[model samples]
Target: MILHVANPIYDSVFKYIMSDERISKTILSALLKKEVVKVEMRPHEYVNTTRDTLSMFRIDFAATVREKDAEGEGFKDRVILIELQKTWLDTETLRFRQYLGAQYSNKINIRKDSPKGFAYPMVAVYLLGHRVGDIEEPVVYVNHDVFDYNGEVVEEGKEDPFVESLTHNSIIVQIPRLKGRVNNRLEKVLSVFDQSRKDAEDKQVLNIDENKYEDDADMMYMLHRLTAAAADSEMRQDMNVEDEYYKAIEDRDTAIMNRDKELKHKDEQLQQKSEQLQQKSEQLQQKSEQLQQKSEQLQQKSEQLQQKSEQLQQKSEQLQQKSEQLQQKSEQLQQKSEQLQQKSEQLNNIVKSLYSKGMNILQIAEITGINKDEVAAILN
Candidate 1:
């Protein structure tokens, strides 16, 4: 009989080992940090039409688990998803988010007593073959912790029914970091898929004996199956084929991640350029407004200067009309002076004629009624 070491990386073996009810319960309970008393397997292949297509997402295993609430009041149903994702990549974040969204959209039956529907809490557990994220911890657990703007945790957020109902818990187990004796429960549980193998020359040394973990029945059963698979010639060939297939996927994912990085860098540059152009446009508009204000001020000054010119022209016209009126009055005064001079000369001539015809000066004066002195002087 040929005895072989267990190789647990194959999907067939993992599924077969987890199909057992007792092992599945123990695994779920440990990962969930709760007591899982009941388990019911759900159909793994189903499309969630309320969200994106199911073609992009797949679940290795899923089940409805019943666990007692933290209050110790009663058992609650948790829709648990167990995923086998080998590598963690930057681009797979969106795909993961979409998968969770689809699961969240699954609603329970509508009750006649209440108008609203009920949704089950979701739990996600991922088995990673390689290191994916920046964190250094071997095992990672993610719980929805709420904080306020001041960075203080809110008690109400943890206790509120609405907030708690929407919260989903997740666990990430990294496998390549495993070596030596599996000490803890989580490490022992994860060891079922510990398929670290040696070359052909040291094939005998690569065997991980089931007796080493005799206390764990689940681990023992899983190791028995893996040893059985290693002994079979056809299953060994099939395992080689699956390994090649997973390698191809990893290669494709790497290429896609590189391309996505390039695209993201280009997008950042374009967004920066767009913001610069908007700023320039605003500055140009401000300059145009300043120029318009200056032009309006110049126009107002020109209008005021034009009004002053018209006022000066009107004063000049009034002055010219007054000079013409003074010239006409001066001519009239000169004519009147000449006419008075001529009348005085005619009176003197008449007096001389009267003196030449007079008998005596006295008689001439009496007759003419002139002064006696003026009459005598005219006669002499």
Candidate 2:
């Protein structure tokens, strides 16, 4: 089955170099402390080639080495390739075989051009992000060699009775199955790769204890940086959401404040109108009271005028009776005419007094024994 692999973790790269080149050199150098020469580092590169119309690929990381072997012999000390795998698939074995073949081919071709026969051993290291079980050891592989009954190796196609024939050699390191079997820097690097793979599969950032893997300092640092980057991305998202939330709240508050202000303004206008209406009502009530008092006073004056009219009517009737008596006695009639003139002057004074008291023409006529039409004509 085809499997898609993800990109290598920074920790994986760091761990690979630490385990193979860095740690191996340190241990081997310490053992041969007297004859070790300078160590050199090379840059990493990725190579892709088409083999039988199918694409094949491999990555080579920086290789470091000491100048001499542990026996103080001057030798082209070390050559290594760093391989990273985000996932393991069926094609992994073939892929590694291709890498091994290419490295062997290149070395053999270079040796053929040289004056002396030289054999340089090559190491191919793979850092895997998945657990590979079913292997008895952390690093296991097949070695092709012709062995005699005494377990001695012979040269390829060279038949020697005492020597076994050597044909092919390969190594395989299963990272996940290496737990609890980590003995060297290489094993520790594999352990870190296993942990990082687990974290990636779980969809979590690596959170390893730096103190525990102090020997793999570069690996720990790389993992820490990646985890921090993820956290920072999350924090930025949260901050943006918080900012938007506050903005919405602010807008809502402003709307509420504006509505309250409008209500207050309307209330103020209503209060002013209410006060004006109350004042108008009070004025109207005062006017009504005054009109009522005026009506009462006018009614009392009308009653007094009615009483005076009855007295004046009785006096007019008496004067008519007196005139009738005078007509029967003509000599007494002239003296009665002077008496009637004095009575008419008193009646005119009473009528003037009633007119000064605000009586209407009809009321004055009724009170002063005068004809209503005659009183109206005099007033006009």
Candidate 3:
């Protein structure tokens, strides 16, 4: 049998169905896979804006879970804090952080029995209307596993408050990936959210085979609730309002993206211009440094030439002094030569005078100390 049911992916439909305590318990049990002894909803604020209408529905459930003892003789009841968050289109990473941080910081999450006031163990469940990264799984569970230095897995104590309070295990359901892959009971339960099951004529309603979930009480109850929601005049009106609201949001987002792209292009042009100017400045600086080096080399060469000129001037002065000394010596030699010539002439005249006086050659020679042959020659 085919039944037309309201699509719970719609914020209004989701809020309508999950607001019921029995429905919340059934969904939690299916997602957590734990036997929930009891569930009590903690207080949370809700806003009715189209944008905020259960866009993020966060509630705390003080849930008591029944677990079998290791000895298998008894069941132990543990109270845990389940921080349930359901989000539609927008699943910002920071938004998840903000919600978790708020929950962790809230003082109401503490246990009343402990003297040190230890916090209750927290488990976070995120129902996303969108996919996360490249993960193709419809359901992703993130749990903290302990390891030793030797890379061996260590078993965590079942009731360790310190480790459990600080860290949490998380379950993420990517509603879009739920498609036709219903391999388990959990998957079958989640198949209702498969957007592929949406009715062709109306997006607000989904077409599902009622026989597939006839044996499951929880599943049937959910289907009946959604069917009622689909028939409600107020619920259908709210869904329409949501449809118009999302359409406007989509248009707004498109406009913003186009503006961002334009701004990015301008930024790139400015950045290119900045880089070009920087390159030119660097080139000019390099040229200036080369010129300064050349100027320093010229100064050094000028100093060398000045030193060489001063050395040549000293050598020229020494050569001038030597030339003057040579001239003085030549003048002294001329005076000596003249004096020798005068002595020679006087001696010759004395010899001639002796010869004219008729003095014997031998007497002249003796007086003048001249050789006899030279005295005779002069007299003749």
Instruction: Report the C-alpha lDDT of model 1 over 163-217, residue by residue, as the tens digit.
Output: 5456767787666666543767776766555546443663322455556678877
Residue 138 in model 2: lDDT = 64
Across 1-380, the per-residue lDDT of candidate 3 in tens digits comes to 99999998777788787778778778887888888878888885533332434357666788888888868799998888888777777656787887789888888888888777789999999989888889999998998877789988776574478777789999999988889888987798788888999999999999999999999898999999999999999999989988887786677668657866875686566556556655655565555556555556666789876665555555555555554555455555555655765775687689877875667779899999989997765443
lDDT for model 3: 0.78
- Kindly indicate the candidate among 1 and 3 with the higher TM-score: 3
- Report lDDT per candidate: 0.55, 0.46, 0.78
Candidate 3 regions exceeding 4 Å error are 46-54, 156-158, 264-380
**Reference-based lDDT, residue 276, model 1:** 57
Error of 3 at 334 (Å): 97
On TM-score, who's better, 1 or 2? 1
Highest-scoring model, lDDT: 3
Number of the predicted model whose TM-score against the real structure is largest:
3
Candidate 2 regions exceeding 4 Å error are 1-57, 61-87, 107-113, 116-119, 128-133, 141-149, 153-169, 179-184, 196-204, 215-380
How many clashing residue pairs, candidate 2?
A: 5
